[model samples]
Target chain A: MAERRRSEATRQAILDAALELAGEVGYAKLSVEGIAARAGAGKQTIYRWWPSKGAVLLDALLAYTTGPSGRIDDVELPDTGDLSADLKAVLRATVEELNDPRLSAPMRALSTEILADPVLAADYADRLETPVRELKLRRLRRAVDAGEVSADADLDVVVDLLWGPLRTRWLYREGPLTKRYTDRVVDTVLNGIRRW
Target chain B: MAERRRSEATRQAILDAALELAGEVGYAKLSVEGIAARAGAGKQTIYRWWPSKGAVLLDALLAYTTGPSGRIDDVELPDTGDLSADLKAVLRATVEELNDPRLSAPMRALSTEILADPVLAADYADRLETPVRELKLRRLRRAVDAGEVSADADLDVVVDLLWGPLRTRWLYREGPLTKRYTDRVVDTVLNGIRRW
Candidate 1:
């Protein structure tokens, strides 16, 4: 039990170091050697745990977002029972989070890392994205059961239609990330779901 | 006239060299010096012509997609008057383009480059994304005029609803980039536009 606890502390140190250096030098210049040095851990320690620097970066982001419990599935998507209001509130919060200056650099760096490596990207999707998406799907499914949304509506498509524009604007710099934008996305996609 | 012709040729050479080096070394290792060496132009010439390696990479992609005419606005979205069919066909073609193996490496590298630099991303939006979106918006407006789509639909939101999901799928590797996926996206967003 003590061994497991020590290992967990080391892992946290490595992830914290990875995030710090990735932000400082950006992902391209981020190195396993540098992360090891910063964490005061052996280089082989990181290699033993992660196949590449991008994988380490991914873990860092997952850890940061999930907090101490690392309970990623503990999503708190508001289900005020008014599906539209719930959606607007959640997406508005997302917009604010994305726009936060503190997160921007690390998020952009993480995106670059994800884009550069497919294996790491898959790990990201499985561990981080899938859990969050499932939680969201549950929320939408509840709405479907309530008859607020069409039974025939593809919940997957509905989720993407609402959130995908924000992804584009964030990654591609297509436009400003704003509450107004997310609100429009929610309303427009709700049109597809509620009626179609 | 002689100076202008030579300068244009030099610009093309630099861009060509940038693309080759970026493909070989990836954008992280791509450099003005390396591009200059390959193009047989001085580093000063490259620096004079482009702000950064990312800027040169952006230009190479634009030039490749736009052809030698450098006309970024020549979008050829099919308008067969069956708005749904037109959209499905075009989105299917897009899926094929994105799936092309020859384009994948460079496209990934370009995405990393864009994500790394905000100025470069803004340039990409102006030079590539905006023109294509305008062409798409025009097609949607045409449908609105034909009474096929609701006049009240925020066409920008409609456009994003269809295309943005694919962007998420592609960039995040969230799902298989398939004709089936694009078709579903097209139909789902069409439901919003046509009915709501």
Candidate 2:
């Protein structure tokens, strides 16, 4: 029991160190050695848990956003019965997250790292993307139950339509991710999905 | 006159070499020195013509897709009188471009490079994204003139809604870029934007 507790503590320290170093130097320049030094843990401890700097950073990001006790599966969309308001709020938060200076560098690095490696991309999809997508689907289903959307509506496509613009703006840096933009997106999409 | 022709020829050779090298070694590993060596041009020559490897690749890709005389502005969407058919045909071609092995790596690299650098991102938006966007907007305006779409429709938002899904899937590697998917996107978006 004591050994298990110590192991868990070490793991948390490593993740915290990784996040700190990632924010400091950015992901491309972040190294395991730097993380180990910051955490006051040995190199062996890091290697024994995570394979690479990217993997460590991914885990750190997940932990940071989801909280210590939370898993990626625990991510939830708002369900205030007003679909437009709920979606705008969620997307606004997303825009904030995307635009956050400390988070943006690591996020960009994460994307580049994922693009460069197939294994990392698959892992990210499985661990992060799938869970977030499922949560959004669940919220949309609730909206359907509330009569905010049609029961026959293709939720998957709707989800893509809702998410695609924000993702494009964030990834491509094509436009400002303002609250007004999110509101417009939600309004336009709801016009299509809402029952007449 | 001879000197100008020779300089243009050297520029073309460097671009070809850069494209060829980017494909062989992947973009992350590609270097100006390697490109200069392969093209049999001095590093100074490459520097005089293009700013970065990403810039060279971007130019090379434009040249590849548009042919020798074609500029980025020359890219046009189809106008088949039926909005659905025209959008799908253009999107299908886009899907093909995204899925092409020869183009995918360089494209991904270009995205990463653009995301990392504000200057490159602005340049990409100006040189590539703006033209494509303008062309699509022009097509939508034509649809409006034909009474297929409502005149009051927010063409810019409509454009984002149409392009977002494809951009998201290609950039994030979230799902397959299939013909059926493109058709579905067009159908759903048109339902929102078209005149009732």
Candidate 3:
């Protein structure tokens, strides 16, 4: 029990240090050596726990958003039985999270890092993208099962449809992702873009 | 006219070489030296023409896409008076261009470059994003004017919504973007995500 506790503590310390440094210097500058020194752990500790810096950073971010007790499993669109309301509530929360200065810098940096470095990119996709996408897909499937969405709706494209606009906005910093906008997206996507 | 012709030829050669090298070695490996060598032009010629690597690459890409037509000035979304077909036709053409092997690699590399490098990111936004956005916005406004879409619909976000899913699929290299998916996105954004 004591060894397990110590291991967990070391793991958290490494993640915390990685997140802080990734935020400060950007993901391009994030190094295992730096993270170890900051976390006061041996470099081997980070290597043992995570395969790469991106993996460490992904875990740190997942931990930051979902918290220790909270899992991605808990991060679902509420089935409050109204699809629109549920989607709006979730998206509004996402708007807040995406806009948060504290989170955005690190996340963007991490994204940039993965894009620039193929090794990090692969690790990020496996550790981060898969889980996030899976969770989102699961939530969307639930919406379909509840007969809230069009039976003919392709969930994969639908997921991209939901995420793509938000990504374009977030990536380019083009405009605001307002509650009004999220509501509009939910409305437009459900109804159809045509004037029928 | 002879001097003018020589200058134009040199510029096109440089751009062609840049595109070729960017595809072969990846964007990070591409440089003025490489492009000049590939084009059989002097390094000074490249410097005399463009300010930065990012600038040169994007110009090369723009030239490749637009061909000898110069800028797409007279280009307007076909207002065939049938809004859905017009939008889908434009979008399908865009989808084809995005998926084209010649364009996709450099475009992806450039996007990756922008994500990693802030300076390049701004350059990309200015060179590529702004014009494309304006073009799309004008097209959407035309649809509104023709009474195909509600005037009150948020045009900017609507445009993003329409293109965003395809982009997400494109960026992630997730799935094949077929006409079926394209039509679905159009229908979804036109209507709404809800089942009535």
True contacts kept of each: 0.49, 0.35, 0.74
**Measured by TM-score, how close is model 2 to the native structure?**
0.89
Q: For model 3, how does the per-residue alpha-carbon lDDT over A26-143 read when each residue is reduced to its tens digit?
A: 8778899999999999998788888888778878887887788436766655677777787788889889888886778778877766666677767666766777788777877787
Interface RMSD of 1: 4.5
lDDT of 2 by residue, A59-173 (tens): 9888878998649776678777777788899989988988886787677778878877888888888887888889999998887777767776677888898888987877777
lDDT measured at residue B80 in model 3 versus the true structure, 0 to 100 = 82
Instruction: List A-chain TM-scores for all predictions.
Output: 0.88, 0.90, 0.87
lDDT of 1 at B155: 83
Worst 10 residues of 1 chain A by lDDT: A187-196
TM-score, per-candidate, Cα-based: 0.81, 0.89, 0.92
Instruction: Write the candidate numbers in order of decreasing lDDT.
Output: 2, 1, 3
Looking at model 2, residue B25 earns an lDDT score of 87
Give, for candidate 3 chain A, the lowest lDDT window spanning 10 residues: A69-78
TM-score of chain A of 3: 0.87
What is candidate 2's local distance difference test score?
A: 0.82
- The lDDT values for all models are 0.81, 0.82, 0.78
Summarize candidate 1's per-residue lDDT along A65-112 as a digit string, tens digits: 889777887756788888889999988887886887456666777776
State interface RMSD in Å for all models.
Answer: 4.5, 5.2, 2.0
